[model samples]
Target: MSNNAIIFISVALILSALSFAMDRQKTIAGFKRGWQMFSRMLLPFLNILIIVSVVLYLISPDDIQHYLGAGSGLLGFAIAAVVGSITLIPAFISYPIAAGLLQQGASYAVVGTFMTTLMMVGVVTLPLEIKYLGRQAAVIRNVLNFFAAIAIGLLIGVIL
Candidate 1:
């Protein structure tokens, strides 16, 4: 594991030990609840992994480079923004996929745009957002976020 992973694991273990020391019953209850949540999520997590794996397998690295690499320019940014806005993968899951895209020759800008929009814009969840925030607010938020994501991507390209 990487140093960061090791550090996080160590910290978590230390915190858990401290919590258990302070309240054994609570710690046990917490563990049980955590395990239950994990079990509930496992199947869907695996399903998403399988689907993403198949999609990645079908799309060649050359195609990824052609569409999202440095030379793809504004077109790549638009594509990433649109797709990211429309898709609804959880943030934690999206990171590994982003790394895979980087490995496959996608530019930092494209990946950055994609990640930003994936998290901030909610085209796929628009109806739900509208229900919660009202149509005008939801639409405005998505529109602003789309532009912000593109700007962030451009900055990432320049900085990285």
Candidate 2:
């Protein structure tokens, strides 16, 4: 395993031990709650992994490069922005997918835009946002985020 992973695990173990020492019952309860949450998320996480793996396999590398590579330019950014805005996928799943896209020859700019929009712009959740935040705030937030994501993607493409 990587050194970072090892260090993280070791630190977690140390902290967990410390917690157990300080409050045994509370530590045990926290562990139980964490395990329950992990178990609940495991199935859906696996399902998403399977679906993403299959999709990645089906799409050709050349196609990815053509659509999302450096040469793709404005069209690529548009595609990435639109799709990213529309998808309601969780960030945890989206990160792996973004890595997969990069591995498949997508441009840094495209991936950056896609990731930014996925996290920032929320077309799918707009109605809910509107309900909670009001129509003006929700719409403005989404619009500003959409533009910011595109600009960031372009900047990443230029810098990288």
Candidate 3:
């Protein structure tokens, strides 16, 4: 294991032991509430994770790597944004798949757009958003977010 991993584990163990000794039954009810809440969220989250992981494993890593390179420039960013807008998958589903793609060589900018639209643009949810806040509002928000994602990817390119 890496030195960082070892240090993190050692520190966590020491801290956990100290806390347990000092506060045995303290916050026990709070812990139960937190755990119940977490379990409720976690079960669905894990189900999605497993599904995404399986789908990601089926895809060729080369395809993901192809998009990640800087060869495409603004065109690549645009492509990324467009693809992102189309796929309305959950963030939990998309993130791990994007991460796996990155590991295979996808461009950070492209993956950034995928990640951005995973949360930002919502063509899938557009009807719902529009129902709640009119078509004009929905379109305006999505347009703003699409451009914002592109701007953000460019900014990161410059800074990083």
What CA RMSD would you report for each candidate?
A: 1.1, 0.8, 3.8
Instruction: Judging by lDDT against the true structure, name the best candidate.
Output: 2
Per residue, candidate 3 scores C-alpha lDDT tens digits across 29-121 of: 556887998888787778777876786677676655554555667777877788888876766567677777677766787778767866899
lDDT of each: 0.94, 0.96, 0.77
Off by over 4 Å in 1: none
- Score every model by TM-score: 0.95, 0.97, 0.69
Clashes of each: 0, 0, 2
User: What is the alpha-carbon RMSD of candidate 2 to the true structure?
Assistant: 0.8
lDDT of 3 at 52: 68
Kindly list the per-residue Cα lDDT of model 2 for residues 1-160, writing each as its tens digit: 9999999999999999999999999999999999999999889888988998998899999999999998998999999999999998888889899999999999999999999999999999999999999999999999999999999998998899
Tens-digit lDDT track of model 1 for 28-72: 999999999999888877787788778878999999999999999
